[model samples]
Target: MKKQTRAIASTLIFAMLLGVTACSKKNSNKSKKKFSVATQAETTEAPSETTESTTESTTETTTETTTEATSNPLGLKIDVPQENCEIQFLPEEERFKYDMVLELNEADHTVGGHVVVNFYNNSSEEWNQLCMRDYSSLFKEAHHDGFQEIEVKEGALTEVTNVMNETTSQALTCNRDADVSVLWIPLDQNLKPGEHMTLSYDFKATIPLVADRYGLSDGVYNVTNFYPILAVYEDGKGFSHEAYYNFGECFYSEISNYHVTLTLPEKMKLLSTGVENTPANADGKNTYTIEAPCVRDFVFCASENFKFFEDDYDGIHIRLVYDEAHPCGDTMDACAEASLQAAKDSFAAFNKAFGKYPYPEVDIVLAPIDAGGMEYPNLIICTVDAMYCLTNSYESFPYEQMAIVVAHELGHQWFMGIVGNNSGMEPWLDESFASYTEFVFYEYLGVEDEMELYSRETFDLTKEPWLTSMQANGILPINRSFYDFEDADSYILAAYSYGKIALYQMEEILGREAFHGILREYVHRNAFTNSTSSRFFGVLLECAGQDNADLNKLIEVLFDI
Candidate 1:
């Protein structure tokens, strides 16, 4: 989910130690020269005139909509039509929605929550049980003392048990595998198809002091995946009970509407996934109500020392939250406007190439993060280190790194946020696409030369070497589960590096216009739902001409399918 650059020789030596020799003999005949820097025609040429005309038309429509929606172009709010905001990609009957009330205790860094979910049985088969992912328990299992207490308040369940709760006194009847992030609640009766059921949960958790998706670092509190969320269910496959993988995303869910209320200290400013309504202050605390429509997940960040800045792009509100004491605080403040504009341009280019971004606002926050950046539905967290490097007036610092990170995360607003994927199984669906989108963003800005330089340094120079080394060592294919890799580094090489290479090879085979057309169709079809590697390959085969033997060979080489 984040971009990382490591040395080449070290990676190869590590891969050899793992006994990855499956592809060694096959790769022996291949020359490294085949992975040379992209040619001028491939990297710097402007898009075709048709693509330019399409961009202009889309920009015009966006401008008209922006003008009609707001008198002040820089306002912090934009009104989007209800129907346009719906998750139209999924069937109307299958949508699941959530109503939650969460109280954050700033003094103790704890959260207590109550959530009511209206889950529709969209599958033809009847349901005998429901499963929810307890992501916070992963922290507990890692020796962090955070507690994830879940009690079923309302549902058709005969009994509820936290199969992973080691401290609970409940009778242990369920299996406890090495992966223990699921809560199994059995239903008293089989829920018929086309019927709906309401399930409510009361939960509590402590915020760990760590640099992760859900934790408190310094004075900022980041809360993500802190609640028990319903797992996506298949008729015959049941729920995807993938264990939490620390290296990559292991969670998957359907798009759902969220109405959340958070009670926190009055002084704390909150930036969350949804639109915040007017806050009510009472007894030294403020209760904020946020409403998010058709989103896969909800996250929030709170800081009493946070400063806020806002801008607008085509009626979409852009806000940045940062602490002045942060290492990149001054840099973030100085570049906030430029960063937001870059994001807008990125969105425009993505919309022109893929599909329209179906949200009215996006919030970018500079925070302490474990990665270069992380993306939610309408929010992105840029790491303080990246921001600092971007702003540092040093010759050694890579100034373009910050822009690439921002663009990559914003790319996820479409890739992972809207067009969903099981990141644990097919991380390339988001990571590789987002990485490729960074190049697209650069191309859209008429900075193809810069993109080429970046690509050479990142992919061609650094990642290609490691990938070649891995290929020579016969490493695992890119399409495996997240935890199947030896470590995070291997996953990054497989998912991000080789994944982007595969996409680029495909683009080279199919012209740019045709490649983008396929991507646009993919977005149009998969928005608000999950996509698999097979479906992606099917789309590629459809657009790239299935009879193309070279393309088929490339796919086989990359995915080993």
Candidate 2:
């Protein structure tokens, strides 16, 4: 975990017919006192009692135990007494047993956080508990089927409240560096390792106008954290818990197969993270499954009045789902084609440069939400209005914005998807790297000189004071929190503007051949595993034979803070 600067949130006031208001929340901040520990112990047996009063007493005893365990603020624990379940990336059908349906409230823009995972535990041990680390900060005990809330001390958990009123609360007993929870206990009452268990819990999430995790605007549903996805419990990274993360730290996990079935209204159209297993008009329902393996978590979108289009370019299936009656229909088509082209270019370049494209199909859908674009494996949910609304006048807007935005998302197929990153700790690994890759696609399109010329021209044209003031000061380092100041531009500068400049500078320093080799080798080395800035910089240093570079300083300056 790295130190981060504070993020300043800004509200976007767009006067659209749908009463849309997309706000951007920056993740930035630093905390000096935070820590965790690890412990190993035998499974505690459910103490038997002689009377109902004894059962009540036992419950009280458990509560007291939890209170005592959490009395020390620094006391938390991570234990792996035994491995009860083994999760692997198999074909979607073989890996998943049921379609995950998340019921969301359109009125409040909240999600039904109930997770029903029908998975099999193939280990031979008797599995009793499902361990999951807490990611959000404001969680209440959810009363749902097949679940129980193990009580811990108050204020013992961290709250993830980036989205107003929507935070996942965590209460851990030990002073473990990471916060974790047993989402479901006893894989099953009479469960053997190879048997299956179905766990379901009802939850509610706060939907922000501009949500980095998940949100909705108008009919467009940006369904992130909509379902209860499993956390990465690995050997080295541990339970993947860092309760306080700024924009710098994004996410860390290995890509697993996703077989999700989203149930929405009959009037809605769906766009998700995998190939559509069912036809578009499958009785107004869309079912998708991954045809190839994905290396990260899944994301999806749903909307009414969404028009669909598809193109099979060089065996890669590309689908564009958006509003059909949009005034920018032609621009939408152009963007769709541009997205496919970017995918083609990225895959071709990445394969030739590093490894192969792991997934078989990719989808790019236009979301109604106005919070810019978000990337998922084989799919990207971006706001159509925002992409087309760059210019003051529709006629003045060029189609290049569409191309560049699409290219950025497509770049994630490598930076974020194939080559896994702990976004919460090293956001540059995804955003900065992805932005740089988009620039590479720009070069592939023979627009490198054109884009750079425009950049130089703009640098000269823009006022220095304005640029300096616009530089982000609210940038918290990765794995840190946006705990201080409020300068929203830091989010853009760190992830987009300065990040692009830094990568371009790296290219100049390493030379084109070695630069590309370093990137390719970095992806190859860390594919399907969480990687950090030092690891990435080390690759560059190895290729460039440079030491004492103070790579972290480079990232800090990227925000121009």
Scored by lDDT, the top model is 1
Per-candidate TM vs. native?
0.76, 0.59
User: Against the true structure, what is every candidate's RMSD?
Assistant: 11.9, 18.6
Model 2 scores worst on lDDT over the 10 consecutive residues at 33-42
**Global lDDT scores for all candidate models:** 0.63, 0.46
Off by over 4 Å in 1: 2-92, 141-178, 386-399, 450-470, 473-476
What digit string (tens of lDDT, one per residue) describes model 1 on residues 1-561?
554222223532332222112112112343122112222222443332332243344334533442112132221122212211222334445568788888987666677677777877777888777777867656653432111122211111112233221212222233323545687666655668877777665777666667666678778888887777888877789878876654467768889888899998898898988678668999999999887767899899988888887754434566787776676656555555545555656665676677656655677887767666788888998766653445473122222334556777898988899788888777888888887786566555544432332233354422456557766544447777666666556677666655665676566566555676667656656778888888787767665566787677667656745
Task: Kindly list the per-residue Cα lDDT of model 2 for residues 1-561, writing each as its tens digit.
Answer: 111112222311111110111000001121111000000110122322222332243333322331111121211121111111111223343343323445445566555433454555444555444444433322322222111222211212222221110111222121213223223232324445556555444444544444233545445666654443445444433344544332333355545545554445557666666554543446554433323234466666767857777654323456778666555655566655544544555554444444445444667876544345667777776555543445422233323334455666777777777677666555666777776765565444433443443242343212364345444354434212222324335554555544555676656544554566566557656666567677876665554554425333444443322
- Model 1 accuracy (lDDT, Cα): 0.63
Give the TM-score (vs. native) of candidate 1. Answer: 0.76
**What is the TM-score (0 to 1) of candidate 2?**
0.59
| Candidate 2 clash figure, as a count | 48
